[model samples]
Target: MRLVRAGRRAFTGNADVLADDDHRAQVTDYFADLVRPFGAGPVTDLSGQSYGEMAKALVAEVVPAAEPVDLLVLAFSIHDVWPGRATATYLSHVCPGTPMSFAVCDQGSASPFTGLRVIGDYGVRRALLVVVEQGALPYESAAATPLAHRGVAMLYEEGAGTRATEVRQYPDVVPEAVPELARRGVAELSTGHPGARVVLSDSLAAVWPDHPDHTRVPAGQPMTGVWWHLAGASEDAVLVGDYDRDLRYLCFAVVAADQSSVD
Candidate 1:
């Protein structure tokens, strides 16, 4: 298993705060503690721009020469709602009139979100997106951008990609809300792959404890999804999301194992 913790910037408990050295240092320290158990070599110090860029850099630097692993733990957060793709975080965007946005990265100026896969062989090979918690209001897409959930609706509406995946959402903010994001993430996981196993996680293991480590925490269930690509789809493993914080701060387990085994 390979664990990687990356952050584009730091909030420093101050939403009004600006991005600067302190924020960078804070991000570094935060990721340092996060990646400690996993290994320093695999951890990347990305404190500016989108995590996708960091992902691009990390894969080129780390994954290429490293050994193969069963799973890759991705812990990334603080990306603008505005859409764009990258190595670390996935991108999606929407315009005001659109029914939904789309997950796009590779086709930055183009139409396809193909650019999302950055890692050489590790691109979409049985990956997982931690479904990290998002702020009440982070940012919005431009009027010129096509907007919606992962921007899938726009493409389907426009007949962009012939293939499409299904996702169902619940109403409640905690269990329902997080699951919505997880479902969307899982849909992204199933793209291009024939069959896949979705891995679940424990909410008790979330990045944040039951109580608030920060001043305010979102009220929701932890969001997580484990995707086994076409290669291991036959295993037919289902993984539930588990974490220390209940839907507050979520991340996938970097090490590969049945995360549901413990409390």
Candidate 2:
């Protein structure tokens, strides 16, 4: 799939009613406790923004082209379980005359990558992929990582815009495979853009090689991989990889918009 336009929004709005000052304080304490156990820094703030609101903000940032979107695909983290049809239903309202809508879940942090595959497989002329993480509240199993509210929306077309050259997954998810998988992924990326570097996920920061040409997206935001490669960084093509221990999945992709071809 090729990228047409991309927009990102980070919410710093009111804390969720459930995450009131007192509750947030408790969450902060828990966050600190998990820091030693989890080895990730505490997530400081929990945004109160609803998923629908953040989705709207993200879409508003994109200046739509003359072409109508053929499909809208929503991708989110496991922390967001608002409802089964919440996203499709809300987006249908926001996007009247919607052609089609769908949501990708159950892949956890890898849902966005799956959403990209959906765009490619659907063969749509134009599609929208929106991914958001509103800081998983301090539920029983949610406080292990730091928290932050961020959303990213990318428009894709079949043969136009920035091309996502390759999206693949490896079966190795053990801690030891991180460096080898990441190294191999980046090496594969270099086949096309020989000078290509990488943007490492925070999870593999410690094990990955000390490359002077890599950017490590911080731990908190789930979709940082997409945001960093598409909107933030200037790499001609970037290799983004993340490992999910529970699922034993290692997902990575190489995306480029600079008219470069994977020859």
**How far is 163's C-alpha from truth in model 1 (Å)?**
7.6
> Model 1 misses residue 9 by how many Å?
20
**Model 1 stretches with alpha carbons more than 4 Å out:** 1-50, 57-76, 79-164, 173-198, 204-263
TM-scores of the models, in the given order?
A: 0.24, 0.74
Winner by lDDT = 2
Pairs with steric clashes in candidate 2: 43-146, 43-147
lDDT of 1 by residue, 58-101 (tens): 33332223322222333432343222233232321111121111
Report every candidate's CA lDDT: 0.27, 0.64
Error of 2 at 11 (Å): 0.6
> Stretches of candidate 2 above 4 Å error?
15-47, 63-65, 79-85, 138-142, 160-163, 210-212, 258-263
